[model samples]
Target: MKPHRYQGSALLLALCCSAGLFLTSPVVAEESLEQRVTRMEKLLESQGLVDLYLRLEALQQEVQMLRGEVEQHGFDMKGIKQRQRDLYLDIDRRLGQLENGRPAVSPGSPAKLPESTAPTAPREQGNPATANPGTEEKAYREAFDLLKEGRYEPARNRFTDFVVRYPNSGYADNAQYWIGEINYVTRAFEQAIVEFQKVLDNYSSSQKQADALLKIGYCHYELKNFAKAREALQAVITRFPKTTPAGLAEKRLQQLKNQGQ
Candidate 1:
């Protein structure tokens, strides 16, 4: 038998072709799978960026709202502090009037108030014929005692009598002033204005002129006469600059302005 050489060569060629086909098929399938996975990864990255952007926008809006709330609270706190200061000033003024005697003011200058624990009697003043110093002092002390005891009616009567009996006495101006204070304390605003006015009319040399004017302003304020109150308070500040009454009038004026008066 002659060797079948052609048959062997043909069979070898078929085997090589089959092996090449097998190797190429697996490479193509792997490349296709990798392209699909890359596409999916790109899509997921784009979606993640969008979600992050949305979250950032929501956080910014919330911060803006919080900032607005903080500003509103600051404004409210300022108003509350202003109201507290006004209230404190009013309370302090009232307590000073009740707990201490009125300071002795000089005709042309601010005078220092006495620090004496006990209320002292007024010194003698004016001519002997017009004012009996001994009797007038005694009567004034009696009325003042009644006032200190809070016996308002009896003190009013006694002071009324003292003013009549000792018109030119040193204590007469104080008695008149006290009468106004009594009316003011009793809420007789109309009468208080009238009585306080008398201090100006009758006692040109009185040390209580500034205080009287200040009280007149307060009376007008209590009566809701804002214009009149402003006028009287301004008068105190202008006429008695650097005095205690002037300072008090200024505080009251600020309070009125705050109230839109």
Candidate 2:
């Protein structure tokens, strides 16, 4: 009876131990599976962070390239604006020249002649000097009017008629001067020189002497006679020191010196 009792107690203890081991093994397996799943989740988050960093770097590079292109375009726009301003200034200068009717001369050239305010009618009398005072003025005024109107040929003819019809008239020198002016303005430099010389030769007392000399110098310059141009310009400065033409001649001389002429 004592042996049987000991055997039964040993069997019961063995069965209890097996049941405890079974339950604890399932709990350990569940904990291991949870740890593995947590590790996988951490690895996936790290990979996503690396991909986002690479995309950000690429976007920054594209922004830098776009900024460089914008700067280049801005530089090109500045150049285009400068060219447009230069073009506008050039057009304005050309239009001003056209409206003036006189060719654009060099920087130190003579100024344009004054416009003549005179009538446009022929004299009915034969001799201009011996004729009535009003008739003489009318004849001179009519000839001058033609010159003011840019009728060069008719002006030349009328002046020639006046000089012939009234040799001793006070306005004869003025008429001759206009003839030279007509030639000078028309670019007939040689003819202008001849006509202007007549003013110095025949009308020494006339006030147009300085003006004629100045034109002579200008004509010589156009003809490329530098020596004669210098001589004539120098003569103007010496002969008419206080005159406006003298100042013009001085300016021209300075220009020549600057040019090494």
Candidate 3:
């Protein structure tokens, strides 16, 4: 009976210990579980891995930054291209404007070209085969025909008109060259010199430039402007030494030297 009582007391102690372990352990575990759940929720929010709206806001910020950088890069590239184009244009203009290049002449200024100042003929009464002319070459041909036909004044008038009507035209340079030729034929050496000078000063790229220099030197020789003639003739030789103009300059310079000595 005493043994049975002690066994019962042992059973009661065991039950108490089991109950204390369960209560204390579950309470602590419950608090820890709540804290762990709260921390997981905060971490999920920070990761932006859930909730469509917050993710979209973060994605939008990234997209906007990328767009801004792309736009800025495009603007910077455009500015660099524009600057390169401007520099190229400036260099091209300078290269083309070399020796004998006349400064940009203002309109209505006294330095206004004499051929440029000549009067125009009325468009009406133009001859057949010379009529219906729309371009500079046609006009120049018509003028050359008139000059050959001994119509001196009309030819001069036509050439002057050609030069004025198409100032930058390819044939306009030829028209100026012809004016000097006409003046040389008529023995107006001073006027011939002036017209030929215009070709050299204004049309550096013209095919007739070398001829213009030759003619100008000839004009100076005719007028007995020997020093001026020597300068013009020598330039023809120096500038176009491989061409017919240079040959003519060398021959004439020798003649002038022979006359002097």
Rank order (by lDDT, best first): 1, 2, 3
Better of 1 and 2 by lDDT: 1
**Which residue pairs in model 3 clash with each other?**
none
How high is each candidate's TM-score?
Answer: 0.53, 0.51, 0.48
User: What RMSD value applies to candidate 2?
Assistant: 16.9
State candidate 2's TM-score: 0.51
- Residues 54-129 of candidate 3 have per-residue lDDT tens digits of 8799999999999999999999999667645643453244224321242334444422223422323323355443
Q: What are the Cα lDDT values of the candidates?
A: 0.78, 0.73, 0.70
Clashes of 2: 0
lDDT string for model 2 (110-162, tens) is 32322221211233556546455455556876886786676889989999898
Provide the lowest-lDDT 10-residue window in model 2: 111-120
Superior by TM-score: candidate 1 or candidate 2: 1
lDDT of 3 at 223: 81
